[model samples]
Target: MHTPTIGDSVDVLDTPSMVVDVSIMDQNIAKMMKRFEDTRKHVRPHLKTVKSPLLAQRLLNAGARGCCVAKVSEAEVMAAAGITDLLITTEIIGTVKIGRLIDLVMKYPTVKVVVDSIYGANELNLAMQQFAPGMKLQVLVEINVGQNRTGIAPGSEAVGLAKHVGGLKHLRLVGVQGYEGHLQHLAKDERVRLCRTAMEKLSATVQQIKDEGLTLDIVTTGGTGTCEICAEFDCVTEVQPGSFVFMDAAYRNAIGTTYGNALSILSTVISRPATDRAVIDAGLKSLSNDSGNAEPKAYSSMRYRPAGDEHGILEWHDLDLRLDIGTRLELIPSHIDTTVNLFDVYYGIRNGIIEAIWPVSARGKVQ
Candidate 1:
């Protein structure tokens, strides 16, 4: 299909740009909303996937309770877009970062953040006390739900951290967020079992906090891989799945999501380096190598390898190659989130002429 036409045509746009199928994106959003229809869980979709406030608005319209961003800067962009309710899933660190977090809360009045350590909670408390003393920051106790990346131990230690953050002057313990990051792509039965096992810790933590006379409002967990499994857990009140909205190569190959390949890097054939090898415009710069390099999914038989910065070498001479000079090809990125930040705006399309240009509003929100 061609790119949907808005005002400008697709041919005039820059190469190696991110092009999204708006219709496909809607379908993806609808599919996720449908999953949460009869369930009690809230779909606080991870905005880190698109990093676009425009897309986040669409997500809200499509039945998301709010958006979950990884950083305070991302929350700022979404708040600027008029999205008042937001959850910062990452651990808010440093005076500078906490200062920004307090600023965001003061600005939006509905922004929340996760804190796993007493040090982080204390820092936030100090920042709020010094600056926005009246601002109330909702804090989610992040438990180690098999990711082991951040978060405290799931049982009593989690309760201790929650109690500490709760007793803080400015920070209020709103809920618990446990991410099953490691279970995102596990084999089906194993993924379910591991996610359940992880939630067991999270559920116990929630109970322990409740036993201490604390209000446990939110018990959020899950990613695209184990969303269904997480939904079944009685403790989990919400899920923060980012990749479901835009299935990347790793997720598509991992979870078998029904969402089509909506996000693609339209690359042009730059050079045929050798008879056994070819090169394209997209590389480590345009796409991402987080999950591994992008593979030629449509052309699975072809061996797609990255040569360097802006070059993707393809060893696909065999199997009747369709690539030629100036031939535009769509590449599925290895990681959707990183690849999306590589562009300024997404060419939102329907039937493909370039329906709209939506900026990546929260791109590079590393702080």
Candidate 2:
């Protein structure tokens, strides 16, 4: 297949090409960042969704204080692109990962991490002392604020963890990260109520840490669904909302298009096997269905289901129109993050023209 170039029409792209509506994506990024412009909180978009150094730089250029990556390997790629300010939201363990993190952090001190246990903190601190001696790694005590994920118990246990990290010569207790991930896709009313409770737990821990004379420079937490309410809280100094940049089917269904769906999988129909059903070149390997099946960009009655790794069956609820074998279509992914990881590059489009081509530089950087 011939490769697409700048100024080429999106129509020239091959099947299952992941493309971004550049105008919509730019607007999405601007809207999300502008939400915090008048507030004390800063927008530190999480790069886990858009795993591209090019896209990450776009967020930074739009007034983001920094960006967050889910893994250390991702931080390396972003830093190599001259984006050093980062926060690794996951706990880093094992000698191999700690070593990689140490090397990365030694060069880029703005890199931060979250530690849920004293053991993890100790191992990280010990590794730094041996390798990058005399330099403290900024750390956040991950608080379990209703997510039941990887975080220290809120209140006393959280305070204890923060205190221990602060006392360490090679570690600095800079903040607390208690992500309400479970509530990101919940109903709005319930999400607000539960987010309030989660913030309370996080705040109490911050208070306790402050009482012990520990530094809490960053109290960061929030996702696309709850960032609005989270920003209103005095406890939250920053919000990490990544998915808003490329709103997916799941987010659109839940959030009602507060941010436009800027990404889609461009596919071509290969077989019209039945009167009401056709097969496309995109499937589980192209668009993820963990949240639910992807939706066709148009044709409201069209329904899509993965037939296999590289094929998807599209059926219509009402046989209003027949799709030809060579017909091209766009599919909005149900889950943006996983779907983005499936593509190697995003053909940025504007008014049907390929305006830019960005490599998914950190596509598989899940270390």
lDDT at 64, model 1: 92
Write the residue-wise lDDT of candidate 1 on 221-248 in tens digits.
8888887788888988998899877788
lDDT of 2 by residue, 83-190 (tens): 899999999999999999999998999999999999999999999899988799999999999999899999899888988998898998889998999999888899
Candidate 2 regions exceeding 4 Å error are none
Candidate 1 clash pair list: 2-351, 2-352, 3-352, 3-353, 4-352, 4-353, 4-354
**Among these predicted structures, which one has the highest TM-score?**
2
Superposition-based RMSD of candidate 2 using all C-alpha atoms, in angstroms:
0.9
Number of backbone collisions per candidate, in order?
7, 0
- lDDT of residue 226 for candidate 1: 83
Which 10 successive residues of model 1 have the least lDDT summed?
Answer: 1-10
